[model samples]
Target: MRNPKKRGAAGNSNRAHGSSAPGVASENTDGGYNAGMAVFSYIIGGIIVWSLIGWGLDFLWGTRWIVLAGALLGAVGGFYLSHMHGLTSSRKNTGDRPAAGGPSQDGGTNAK
Candidate 1:
């Protein structure tokens, strides 16, 4: 047999303290913000690398358009590669596979 008065008291206390439950943890406590920043870093790294290359080429050839092209290419390619590899691989490693019958980010289908 359960004590109804004890249960009610517990619930009332939880309500008073703005708590959802006795021992349940919240969902926003993970490292998602860090992961997002890391991805951004990768994109920025690609742009810097390409920019340096373009700068060197310009220095050698005395042109002004190569650096812009390099920056553009770096941004696009970096984002694509990061989306395809970084995010998907992390999800796959964490056992959260993609949707069914769809191409996943890890170069494989999420078939059951």
Candidate 2:
């Protein structure tokens, strides 16, 4: 009969804690403050840059609506980009899979 594979110290600790390895920190470990800051920066930065461009265009074309449109577009784009990147990073750190989006066994998307 073949001997059963043995679980090492780290392996046993991980299994015991429902697959979360000891000393592992989640993506949102610090009350999501970092992510919040990142998203905020994205939105604010986008607004500032696009609004400046719009202001310059308005100065040249004498149109008042361009700034509004640019700001709105920038906000939407920033929110979208931030949300996408956040999801991707969270999935990566939490071992989410590509198929069903659940946790993966290898701490990331399944290789096969």
Candidate 3:
């Protein structure tokens, strides 16, 4: 009788497998996680930078409400940037199969 193979350490990596291991599962090089983190960083960075700018402006102008406006602007801009750069492409590549607006796929859009 032959024994079945078992999965260990969750998955494999380029360093472990030595070179690009296509079709293999791995966590060290997860594109989704990386994209998510990048989007999150954009949001947080926007907030921090804009808030600081607002603070400086407020200090120069002796106003108190500009900081709030700056924060809100930052959040909106961040969302826009993330959606424009990181998410749209990911949306198209949602699964292992080809995306929409393309031929040679098994099916079309799913009902929501």
Identify the candidate with maximal lDDT: 3
lDDT of each: 0.69, 0.70, 0.73
Q: Under the 3 Å rule for N, CA and C atoms, how many clashes does model 2 have?
A: 0
Q: lDDT tens digits, residues 1-112, model 1? A: 6677676654475542533654433454444665576568778988988988998999899999899888888887778877875542444333566557845677566655
Candidate 3 error regions (>4 Å): 1-30, 88-90, 93-112
Q: Any residue pairs clashing in model 2, and if so which?
A: none
Per-candidate TM-scores read: 0.49, 0.52, 0.55
lDDT of 3 by residue, 1-112 (tens): 3333654454443245534555433555556765777778888999999999999999999999898889999988888999887553644444787655846464656534
List the pairs of residues colliding in candidate 3: none
Choose the strongest candidate by TM-score: 3
Worst 10 residues of 3 by lDDT: 10-19
Error of 3 at 36 (Å): 0.6
Ranking 2 against 3 by TM-score, winner: 3
> If ranked by lDDT, best first, what sequence of candidates would result?
3, 2, 1
Better of 1 and 3 by TM-score: 3
The clash numbers for all candidates, in the given order, read 0, 0, 0
Give lDDT: candidate 1, residue 71. Answer: 88
